[model samples]
Target: MAASAEKLLNLLLRHGSLSRADLAKAMHLSRPAVSGLVDGLIRQGVLRETGCGASNGGKPPIMLEPVAERFGTIGVDIGHETLLRGVLCDASGKQLAVMELPHGNTFESISEQALKLAASLKAAASIPVAGFGVAVAGQVDHAANEIVYCANFPLKNRGLAERLAAGSGLTVRLDNRARAAAQWEYYFGAADNAEDFIFISAERGIGTAIYLDGKLFSGRAGVAGEIRSLLLPSPDGIGLLPVEQAMSEKFLLELSGNCPDTAGLVTAWRRGEPGAVRTVDYLIGGTVYVTGLLTNLLDPALIVLGGRFRDLGPEFARELATRLKVDPPRQLEFRLSKSGRIGAALGAALGVILENCKSNEP
Candidate 1:
């Protein structure tokens, strides 16, 4: 990529749009160089003339912005508590359409389910879909694109993405959900401004994915974030199971009414009912204890909270931060992700994008 073009793309992604002179100043590139790159992007349909913008002096320039509707990508995240959230985006990652699929454990149905997900997405797509991405909750062998172990969807360990690709006639890419979600943070969210960060999530299960020196820290077995299996001791004599059992999708639902779904718990939490706050307190407390241990060991620059449970934002961060102070957590920055649920989907798509970029792009 041309150096000036790359800088202009980054600026456009971060700030949404800019007139030619504004982009030139932001990138510190000459006006002619900026204009050349912007013209190329416009001709490729990667950027478009959105309209005029006011100027402090002289006539207003035609405002330019990313043309995100020109292309699209599909992102899938599936685990014990399954979901198929596919985003249609352009080169700049502006979401055009989204289709969501949520289900429970049903692992024995992986092949058929994956095909269904792809087909449904292809059917609903309004534009040419360029790629497909899948993120699973488990340790991954990215070279083989296979899940090594999954607590939620055990059968997902097979060549599931390949099987789906054969069924749909579209090449597929797969990655660990934690790492994929963390990838979103590194490329597009809070971690975008940091060199290294740790991401923890709570969905049907608790998952962790770390980024170090601007890359996914998939040390050894690509199992860096399997903290659900950390096995902390319980306060009572009951010997600890994984903290996921104590503070996860199952626990949240159990903490609220014994609904068959996590939606009930979120609904109650959003309502700010006393029971919901108490439940959040208990779970966040456990999360803080475990995360404090991680901070001492991993020592990431920032700690990001993602996944479904993070919807409980301030309550989640406050409890985690407050308790950490008592034990003196060695100064970890606890923050909610800027991308939220959308980041998970973007992470999945990025797995595919990264693969192609490394091999096919010049």
Candidate 2:
């Protein structure tokens, strides 16, 4: 598992299949070096000879592909409310099994629930389970395998990854839910070809995840995407408001006064109810402002809107684009996340799969 071998395998995984000549050209290595690596991989059962590539008036080259069914990983998303969602995925990121467990309030209870669910998923997986990844709704101290702080659940200072690994007997990785969702989208969702983009997770709170140059741009403290702290002008004419206070589901419901849920507010707005319509308009304005600022600063090629925005439907994206005030040249693509609520969970699984693969490299 030399670095060259790992690169060859990764290229095959990304491109589906490749000939030794293609791998040598991509890795700037000689054919003999790539041939050695490929031979080793084939012997290890990690890769297989798929078929033959069309030749340039020479012997047809053998194409190679990763053995997708040889390895799998478990992903768990710890939600803000009371549900812990889990998924089992192969190395190629295909879902094998999915389950949801009722989450407990305390750290011990939640850890136990996730462990149980993960165990079940591992039992159901057809391939060998490499590890587990947990996506939490707040800050994660990945090195320590702990949740630094999370508003949705009382999990501050909890050694979540360590406990889960100990309980389930697997390697574990943890990350912020928004960041994990961004990873999922970049690898398997709408942003597959995008190297730079912004992911806005408008759930119980407003969270942003930045990707730059094909990497997740986690700032010094990994709090780079906490958009909830972004302060903007308030519609009430009282004072400035934080992005979360102005656009979150709870705040929007409060603004509408009579709506008990997002569905109710959507219904009211559809019926031309003044309060609901006004609140929706205000939220849209705030979103436009935030997106405009981000476009000017980052200039990403795409912006993915997820969580509650998905619940708001297609009209929100259309309105946000129409209302955006960025320069014409800076206009960017906006997409609603196709992964929906399970994105974070899938991302967690992807993370573990990647970690295991990387760790296996020499």
Candidate 3:
């Protein structure tokens, strides 16, 4: 069931639709076997048949879509700044329930708070959470299953996965939220159509998720997108600065005097406020400079924008694209992800879903 379903869905996602014959050839299964699985899924209401295709002088083949409300995965995005947003995503990438964790950023405090959120959401999940993926803003050690460091978070020691897993009785894992978002785009967003691209996430922190040769480029060390490169010098000339130093939630707030970093920017940008425009420009500089520095290295074909600032909308994306055009990559496309906040959690869920979908040895 897992292998056939994965092959079928991957085919659907890739080609938009496929007949049972196409699926059988793609999955190396017999037509009868594929039909049985498709029938089962259709009856379960998780796969819907629609449309018609060429029929070689016979009845046209019916197309199908993975139901948007089948199985759900719990995704946790923990901010270094004491905010946590959890979302339940069904098999088709639709968001179900969102559990926001609003608590102080202490390790113990957030852990306890997260446990409660997980417990409540777990009970709420109509079908068990297919898996749990917890993404964080700071350094995370996937192999060790711990958070090495998250300066913005009030938590002293990291690693919240263990506590959440123990409390909820579910398998859990950690990933850098931005990279997770990039993975989501590569799988389901604007980048889905591009062979290579970079996912730049800007909000409180600046992060990158580069995709090359049609795969999310998570480096050997798992820190490919963390551009801490004090490499980006601020025009003010106050001190050597990292790309994030000149552009983050903290920097934006300092620019405006007060307000939640992302939400406030959304409101300000909507009103055409001067301060918002300036800060937005500052953030664009970091993105522009980073692209300039890395273009020679990765030579991405596109760049997709996501994260909290995604709420700022297409205008922000256009502004960045206008500047980026000044020193464009050798060749690259630009897009803003609709996945936005949902990407991180969806990628986390994909981690678990795809894991269970591996084929048995032939």
Candidate 4:
């Protein structure tokens, strides 16, 4: 595959259906060149013609879309604690099947469980599974195909990607779960039209992924999104604490009388419970602080809130706008992600497809 072909494929993956003329204009190439790329991809079984588009006064041009029943990828999101999520996605980033499991006690058991999950997802796929992606919370060595270190996860510096590839006989990828979630938001969720934005995931801790000019920004050493150590005013207005402690799920649960989860905390807040109300207010403050910090530094066009906090619904976004203040001539948008629990898994699979395009793989 040529570079132009990869770009065309990615464009279609993002925008869905487009005609050859639209592709030519977007790619800044001649119609012949775009046609050639389209034809080649169609022959390769990744792209397909999807009927015709409306035209002004001439014959309608043929529209193209990704083949949703052919090439596919499997993804596994290893959560910080007991939860693990897996999904089988087509080339167009649509989830065809999903599976969930509890994390195993040890590294070997977890690895085996992940492999089995991947195998099960592959078996459930109607299309050919081209690759497997594993998304974790902490550092990842993509070049080495290993998990460098995840504070809350059991595995450390394990050749998880290689082990999965060898076990499943497919290409493998490893990445940060926050970044993977960001990818899902950018392509299929609220940030579809955004070129610069911040995706904040409030899970066990605070994690973020930055997109500048439509590209994911991984800072030097691939730790750009790790803000867990950033110190801020504590929720109780008692001195300062790191984000991991100040805005963590554990803190929220504890503050809400150890509610089973965020959903229950919301229920308590709805009932006008003082503890739950305080907890929600504290989280809102923390989110506003973090959003302000990032917005001032980067001046992004949008901010997306994900993870357990998404259950807070539109009221969270509305409250964030009320508390967060920005200067004149610069407007910021906030949106809550609707990707659900399978979002990271879907994004991990989409990562495999995007990487495949970049690598010129079939």
**Candidate with the greatest TM-score versus the true structure:** 4
lDDT of 1 by residue, 173-228 (tens): 77877788887777678776776778988776778887777667787877876777
The backbone clash count of each candidate, in order, is 0, 0, 2, 0
For candidate 3, list the clashing residue pairs, or say none: 80-153, 204-249
Candidate 2 minimal-lDDT segment of 10 residues = 353-362
Q: Number of clashes in model 3?
A: 2
For model 4, the run of ten residues with the poorest summed lDDT: 353-362
Residue 80 accuracy (lDDT) in model 4: 51
Evaluate all candidate structures by whole-model CA lDDT and list the values in order: 0.70, 0.83, 0.71, 0.84
Candidate 3 lDDT score at position 287: 71
- The true-versus-predicted C-alpha distance at residue 200 of model 2, in Å, is 1.1
> Taking the tens digit of each residue's C-alpha lDDT, what string does model 4 give over 130-224?
89988888788878877887887776877778778889999889988889989988888879799999998777556799999999999988888
Name model 3 segments beyond 4 Å from true: 1-9, 13-17, 21-59, 64-70, 154-159, 256-274, 325-331, 359-362
TM agreement with the true structure for every prediction? 0.76, 0.89, 0.81, 0.95
Clashing pairs in 4: none
Model 1, position 115, has a per-residue lDDT of 65
- Candidate 4, TM-score vs. the true structure? 0.95
Task: Report each candidate's C-alpha RMSD, comma-separated, in the order given.
Answer: 4.4, 2.6, 4.0, 1.7
lDDT of each residue in 1-362, candidate 3, tens digit only: 77677667666654556888888887899999989888876876656887898888888888777665556777777754656677776766656777777768667777787777777777787875767887777667778878776756753344577777887788887777887777777766778678678887765566788877767677877778678655665546566677676666777667754556678876886776877767677766777777656665677777787775466677766766677643443556567786766677667766665544443111
Error of 3 at 348 (Å): 2.0
